[model samples]
Target: MKNLFFSREKIVQTFETLQGLIDGIRADGKIKNEEVIALKSWVKAHNYLEMRRPFNDIINIVKTAVSDHVLSEDEILDIKYVCKKFLDTYGGSKMGHLHGFASGIASDGELNEVEWKSLAKWIHTYDYLRGSWPYDEINALVHKHRSTLDLSSEEKEIIIYYFNDFCGLNKNSSLTHPLNEPNKPITGICAVCPDIEVYERTFCLTGESKKYSRDEITDKIFECGGIYKNDMSNLIDYLVVCSEGSPMWIYSCYGRKVEKAIAMRKAGHPIQIIHEFDLLDALEDAA
Candidate 1:
């Protein structure tokens, strides 16, 4: 049963990656021959996922869409609809897709004028994400460099690093050389110390913690008269994001749960999203 659960999780993650790749290819508003080739290659590379429902469906759709070396508007819409249905069913977050889109656009290792403009347009289109972690940071970075004819090597590397970290792809090694200065601390984490409550309230966790295994965290929650849920929902009272980084995170420092919490909060649910440290403090206080 455990293995089956993990297998399903892997399939969903891969599907999200595919969505990101497709979004990246379309970012520039025009898909070139080479981009089509790249897309085909990506699908072929993930052919191992063919046994899964959506993968089987997506693989067939992509194969037919690009089989003739031409991607028509109808084909694009078909692919989009399939991906949308899967996301809607599985609760895929827009933030996750946004990070994937960033990773996709930068996968080629170059940011061109068209791609930059498209990225900016995307950020603007999702204005609701404005004050969230990484969104504001990314928005600023895109606008700051929009006027440049070509991004400097360092600038490009910074953007790439952001995308990699955001997409949980920065484990083991930096994608580029270490910067002389530290990268800015991620913003949009709750700026004020939240008054956290534990007893009888439901909690959902995202990202990874440097200090505790998930089981250990759940144990602590149980000990503190709190409940831990594996999925995010409107009933959750708090969404605890681990401050540490991990490759397992769908988004590096945060994940889909955080996005859902943000959306929930925006809708007036009073759900408090806090860092693991804040959770620790609350646990200690409860103790």
Candidate 2:
């Protein structure tokens, strides 16, 4: 508490102020309570000078929300993106730990970036986690960055904290591929994405497919900096396909058939691929 650069009371105040603005957005449109809370938490962690960009953009969103402006998912993500940039610049230690924890959550269960970020921030900042985490005298357990999803809290703390000791800081730990009934099933998602790298070797098929919900696919594209869209004209770089079953449908364009559909519409090809893939999944499967 000594020499505090930012106080908890002020942060909570900011959330309250933004909540009123967001209420206006919700009045015009259906802004979920969860999303509103996430936005407030993102704003609460930082000072105004550092948060201007996200805050201003959020204010605009509020104004737009009041008018029922067409807010795309990417635009909503921008709020989190800007907040992330702000946190990176301002230094988020517990936030950083939550960042890592969020990764594990995604590994075990399905979560969008927004949901993941929200979960991490909430777990780290809420009275439950902040007041409860045993920050002192970390027990040592060498985990080699192994997954602790199944471990009890005591076991997890021992594994993770000791993991820090074993691997040292800056260690890139690998996830454990466990075989068990309760474990995550094989959910492979094939994505035919555009070459999104800003450097050389651009415009090629991206590998490392996701396996789970479409949300996972979107998170992948977001990580790669690829934009997800509804059609060929906007499908700038990549065409993605994801499913919990059948990678073999790939030849028939299983998940990727949409791109082929758009191409077919332009060049004249078969259009049966749409029935095989879920249209709703394609739309929501983004960062």
Candidate 3:
């Protein structure tokens, strides 16, 4: 009985590893020579003979993408469909699968865009809101086997934060500009000019940006010599509105921030509420 149970557990583990392998391959759209070597090498090293058929299927699919060295929309959709199909039959440990995939991609030094898409999809699919959050699970796993995994403190931190951002937890660290800042940009004194240089400009962002995350926008702001603040105050020089005129954005989002900025402006503060594109232009001009 003990042997039978252990055997079943091992099989499940194998499936999880397989899922991770597929994910790592799908990440970054095109499989790199290094990734192909890493995947095939890892499987062979582990002696996953039973998984050879399905593994080869995935490898073939990836190879189709590799010929062009770019993943098209159709190719991306096909890969996602194939991965889902495989998961349906051999669903094992979601956390194990994610870790496996993440580790495989990171093995090559940096996780790419395709890889992030794969991880984010799986993380959302297994969100703790339903079962276990991938971020928490990975962190726990690292803590349990930190030394065994040979994880550097920095590597562990990166993995944890990646999962957090992927899962939309947005947990702020020193790496991110904090949403809450004490120095509100004073308004009335500042000029509201479209031609204003981004350097030393104070910006308060509101509404959902379609193409940029808050962090990305903040990073751009810093790069352009601008300051990003989450709230509105007399000190804010510009309010970058990403989603204006949309009912959801106007009614359900940033209502308070918008109101406060308006009130400050009415009170003779010089805060100008501009569109996200305008902010981008300002950044480009400064660049």
| Candidate 3 residue-wise lDDT, 159-263, digit = tens | 544433321223342223232123321111112233455789899888778778889989999998889888677778887777633212232245567657655
Q: Please, what is the whole-model Cα lDDT of each candidate in the order they appear?
A: 0.67, 0.33, 0.54
Q: Between 1 and 3, whose lDDT is larger?
A: 1
- Relative to the unseen true structure, what is the Cα RMSD of model 1? 10.8
The number of clashing residue pairs in each candidate reads 0, 5, 10
RMSD of each: 10.8, 19.7, 18.7
- By TM-score, the better pick of 2 and 3 is 3
TM-score of 2: 0.22
Mind giving the per-residue lDDT tens digits that candidate 2 earns over 48-146?
A: 434353345555543443234244455545544544555455544442343333322222123233432344334434333221111111110111112
Candidate 2 segments whose C-alpha is farther than 4 A from its true place = 1-57, 62-71, 95-287
Ranking by TM-score: 1, 3, 2
Off by over 4 Å in 3: 1-6, 48-90, 129-287
A best-first ranking of the candidates according to their lDDT comes to 1, 3, 2
Q: State the displacement of the C-alpha of residue 104, model 3, in Å, after optimal TM-score superposition.
A: 3.2
Leading candidate by TM-score? 1
Among the numbered candidates, top lDDT falls to 1
Off by over 4 Å in 1: 1-3, 6-17, 64-72, 130-137, 157-287
lDDT of candidate model 2 versus the reference:
0.33
Report how far off residue 75 is in candidate 1 (Å).
3.0
